[model samples]
Target: MSPLVHSGPRAPLRWAACTCSRDPAFVVDPAVQLVFKHQGGYATLERVEDGGTSAHEKNEPRFRPYDGRVHGVLYRVTREDFEKLAKREGGYVVQELQVQTYDDSQYNALVFVSNPLFKLPQEVIPTEKYLARVREGARDNYLDPAYQAFLSGINTVPGAGLGSEYYNTPSKYMGYSFLVIAALITLAFFFQH
Candidate 1:
């Protein structure tokens, strides 16, 4: 499981430990150190909405190869679940990686790496809500304390309302104007009658 966004208690989605009926769906395996091919890194981009507006940009997280190793939780999932997860992760590619647990036990694992075809021109600061998920995952999975502090110190951009207000205010005001005009027309009709 990805420690950056999907391994913690507060993860948006839960990963089942195994296909067996007795196993719980939300299980946090022991922390592991993963050496990704090409030095995987985390990033986010401005989510371009309709009219090229970036209202939802700050919350999207992407993982690509750069210059860092990823800290993650290990889970034993069924092959079917793995396929489903791969399908769900549309923009990512699956890479077989070697991961080492704290006990120095090593195993081959499937990891999601951002598709090389889809490269962002630049990265923007992620939103607090998104970073909170990452931080929570790191803390809950018992990642290195120093790494957790680093995650906590990460700077975050404001969320949709604050970050994109300038781009959306005109359209918002326009919608309000339409509502006001409709109300006035209804009032005029009722008064005239």
Candidate 2:
């Protein structure tokens, strides 16, 4: 589940908005900016064509070219947190990726991708609530005005489950405490048997 879609607690992350090529990219080990996506994981292509280039996807948009960069945020996470995030985003599979910073710096990072098995039939418009949280976050972080403007005009529905503030504010710590308590209880029950 996307953080925007979840009404539950937020996963902790230190992140910043950046760009990633929407085109095919591969992940490689090195300190330099990578021009590719990791070959072992699922592809994030918005659409695929018939054997166009990627063995990863079968169908692609007939006439459109996907060789541009799109804005995305990068999260720095620990291995444990990475696992938790993947589990939380029911459809996401985690993979290590190399991303280029605005200054041309590169870092190996963990990214969450939608499971190909569950990808939408066609690229669907992002939900209003989803767009709202992104806007709120951009504002909160004082992201580049150009990027904020880009988000402002996107189509959206009315206020969703919760407003965009859910993304701006820190999620409740109580939820984590509850999860820990529940895990202990489950373990105790199993051991007692």
Candidate 3:
């Protein structure tokens, strides 16, 4: 039987703004910097901000001295769109997208940032094509019962649970303690003799 699909109203996009630094001295790096920019832009485009300050506000023309730091943006996107983008461009790794919501709202805006490993492309692939490929791949490889059983086996081996068995066993010091107690008893017996 096909997996149960939960159908519900689409979620709104949410967004936030943040600043990133790339200098070695700075904790934030180029990858993080791009994420801030992307997320900020995405949020602005969605217009999810109604009563709160946004990363776009800080980047406005009037707000001068925009060092692109100490500012970041966040927002949300449709699950379908997120999945499509993730498959097409190695998902969020190629373009890290951060999203958050303020209270409860109709739509959400997400922050888009460029990953240090990959620069944001001027032209983005459409979400449809990416999702199609992902679906195709899943059908081809992940649906096999054999493959699923193999994966389950790998995941359920003993001693693999919660790390190694040694973690639960007593330490060598405990053995030494028993030995010391035995030695003390022997000495007492000799004195009684």
- Winning model by lDDT: 1
**What are the Cα lDDT values of the candidates?**
0.48, 0.44, 0.29
Candidate numbers sorted by lDDT from highest down: 1, 2, 3
Model 1, span 1-193: residue lDDT tens: 2334443565433544333221111112222222111111233222233444232232333333222234556667667766766776755677666666656667776667545443333343556776677678677667766666656655676565533322232334566899999999999999999
Tens digit of lDDT per residue, candidate 3, span 8-32? Answer: 1332211112122111111122222
Runs in model 2 deviating more than 4 A are 1-68, 158-193
How would you encode candidate 2's per-residue C-alpha lDDT over 1-193 as one tens digit per residue? 1234333346443232212222212233222221112121112433233444432123332222223343455544466755655776654576666765554666666666555444443332345655577677666545456656755754444444533322221123445677999999999999999
Each prediction's TM-score against the native? Answer: 0.51, 0.48, 0.19
By TM-score, is 1 or 2 better? 1
Error of 1 at 99 (Å): 1.7
**146 Cα displacement, candidate 1 (Å):** 1.2
Alpha carbon lDDT of residue 15, candidate 2?
34
After superposing candidate 3, which stretches have Cα over 4 Å from the reference?
1-64, 67-75, 90-112, 119-193
- Which prediction has more favorable lDDT, 1 or 3? 1
Estimate candidate 2's RMSD in Å: 12.4
* Candidate topping TM-score: 1
